[model samples]
Target: MKMDYEQNAKIFKALSDSSRLKIIDILSCGEKCACDILEYFDFTQPTLSHHMKVLSDCGLVEVRKEGLWNYYSLDINNCNKLTLFMMNLVTETKDCICKNKSNCTCK
Candidate 1:
């Protein structure tokens, strides 16, 4: 599949926040209710919601609503794709963006 630079950029931007990175780490263990996640930090519910929304929007997180609480977990497929993307990005693959550049010094 062709890479969507904008989408990847958004995903990276969402991950740029330390809180969101920690949130990902928390969810890595398993899906957890919002309250359980909040226990790790001193933020308010609304702030957590905002962070979750950012994560969710980037396709890095998946959420489910049970009654009034939101449960969150990592989107494993997308996370794997992101990892592959980073790997490909740093390697000199045939599809590398610099393949056509004469100045590319990648060996």
Candidate 2:
């Protein structure tokens, strides 16, 4: 699939904030209610909600309402896109070591 640079940028920008990054890390384990997420930080409920809003708006996280509580989980497809993008950045060398004997700098 073609990469959406703007969408990826939004996801990264949402993660730029330490609080939001923390939220993502917490949710990475599994879906979590807003209250459970709040317990990990000292921020106010509204503040935590704002962070979640940014994450949801960026498409990096998914939000669902389970009765009185709001639960969140990472958007796996978008997460994979971001992961693959970073992987591509690290694997810039195109040729395999087997293809070149002397100039193969890959380790």
Give lDDT for model 1. 0.92
Question: Which run of 10 residues does model 1 get worst, by summed lDDT?
Answer: 91-100
Candidate-wise lDDT, in order: 0.92, 0.84
List the candidates' TM-scores in order: 0.91, 0.79
Best by lDDT: 1
Model 1: CA > 4 A from native? 101-107
Best by TM-score: 1
| Worst-scoring 10-residue span by lDDT in model 2 | 90-99
Tell me the tens digit of each residue's lDDT in model 2 across 7-30.
777888888899998888998899
| RMSD (Cα, Å) of model 2 | 5.4
TM-score of 2: 0.79
